[model samples]
Target: MIKNSDITVVVQGPVVASPDRAMDEGITEKCLTSVRHHLPGAHVILSTWQGQPVEGLDYDELLLNEDPGSNITEYTADGKPDASNNNRQIVSSREGLKRVKTPYAMKLRSDNYLVGDQFKFLQASFPERCEEDRFLSERVVVNNTFTRAYARSRRVALHMCDFFYFGRTEDVRALWGMSNLPDLAYDQTRNGQKQYWGAPHYKIDCTQKLLLVALQQYDASLNVEHLHDAPDDLIARSERIYANNFVIGEPELIGLGLCSKFGPQERANRLSGRLTYVNFDDWQVLYKTYCDAEFPLGMAPLRIRKRNFLRAFLLAAKLLEEALKRLKKKA
Candidate 1:
């Protein structure tokens, strides 16, 4: 059993007030207060940009880092977004992880807060692992925000959620201890600033880049050149990666409380069943596939997205009707 005292909470990110936030308190204040309320004995570290307002913030220690300005390039090779705070995130989280003294540490966004301590109970859960891929003392706990399911429509490989992480201190450090994004990335000849390669199919987000770097530590030969590199082997490798190295849970189950900006309506539109994001149940399927020896293959079923399917079917029918009318007129 993990005690609250054994954990250090590192709330890293710029403090910015959201219009959706319910309380008038500053974002950092709400975050710190929640840490105090839910994990009373845990140490709290506030890691943010230098010169940010720090007065009245509750924290055992404060780390003010020089803002590594956002890396903004011309449009990507496939013409997608080019601006990302990848460097800023790396600098802030890496510095915070370096200061963690406890056996366990959680990396929470400064804009987010804890609502409960249930995630502590999950630290020791899911003990089974695929011996080959297991790296951490325990699987790092992360919310199911952008942990993509390759089998889903929103398929992408190595897209680990970076919003939060709760696990062994060193393990959490390893996850964030990655090189900052280079100013020049992807096919630079076309745009001279294409920071990422895949667009249309997959945009290499910060989390994806972060996890790819971390995975290379264990498997030096895992050469992923593009964002949409989801071959069957890569897909299976990703499944095992999540199975042995991380636990994906609902934000609530993980004691993570998103700001009001991510309320019910946003969640309903952005996140759905296991098809879009890897929920706890989806993680369980991967766990059984790689960890549980006796678990039969193909037994872990994925839920179908009924509503999306219906929408697609109706759109296809309408398109066919329009095409038929055009053909009759031409005849």
Candidate 2:
């Protein structure tokens, strides 16, 4: 748990890149690494765009700040501009920083980089559907497994510490396979249809949901809580509908336990346990192999939005404080 004195849980990206171009600082990797590096002992979870089950990383449930060895400069990509910074007339965003949150750690992101392979666009298409579950058969899937995998504690949401960008979420380029969901959500939505590309119609929004719920739980009790208010038997039934019982659901899906009776701190504990911090891993292999050679067009993966930084920060802080009051029994 973050000390009452700690203020920022710097959040950052849902960064993107070719599988071969090196995703050293991608969202999953960033979250994993941050947890490993900063929050050392905290349990770390690796998440894909909509919560797909992919793992080469993990989080430990321990805190480093309580110790001295973990002290490091925390900043978003604030140290220097992207690779193009050396050139003149280039529009480099001076604003670069992300709020990084993990079960045991959180920080403002920095130096998170993805090797650019702008020429990989030609290879844009979903893979042949997996005979098992079509969602994972494609390149993306729902990221709810984080909770299912670590069903030991309550997982609350961490509000945006930085910007999160799901790259290629929608492919306007063609009448194609699975378009990137994140990119497509921003597209003009139809009256009824969710802005999407193909079938296997799973909707993704765990990260956002987690944050909203987490912010509301802080300082609310000595344990984790859920929803905007205490749930009567009637209201709790309703929560199961959307959350599908994920974290705060009526049945409470995607949390730390099966015996759903969270008071205050208990619920907060679950949220803290389940949050994933994006970290780095492979991508350069595919970028160099398929993307660079086959298509030579990349999405220029990034998350750009000056407007969200403050909003997310304030919301996160407010939510955390409120939850804290309840958890500490101060509420």
Off by over 4 Å in 1: 17-25, 73-81, 150-154, 185-195, 199-201, 267-274, 294-331
lDDT, candidate 1, equals 0.76
- lDDT tens digits by residue: candidate 1, 249-304: 88888999887666666653353433456777677778887898665435335343
Give the clash count for each candidate. 0, 102
| Candidate 1 global TM-score | 0.82
Question: What Cα-based lDDT does every candidate model obtain?
Answer: 0.76, 0.25
In model 1, the clashing pairs are: none
Assess the local accuracy of residue 47 in candidate 1 as a C-alpha lDDT between 0 and 100.
90
User: Which parts of model 2 have CA positions greater than 4 angstroms off?
Assistant: 1-27, 50-53, 60-331
Tens-place lDDT per residue, model 2, 77-138, is 23221121111000011111111232112222222311221111212232222122111111
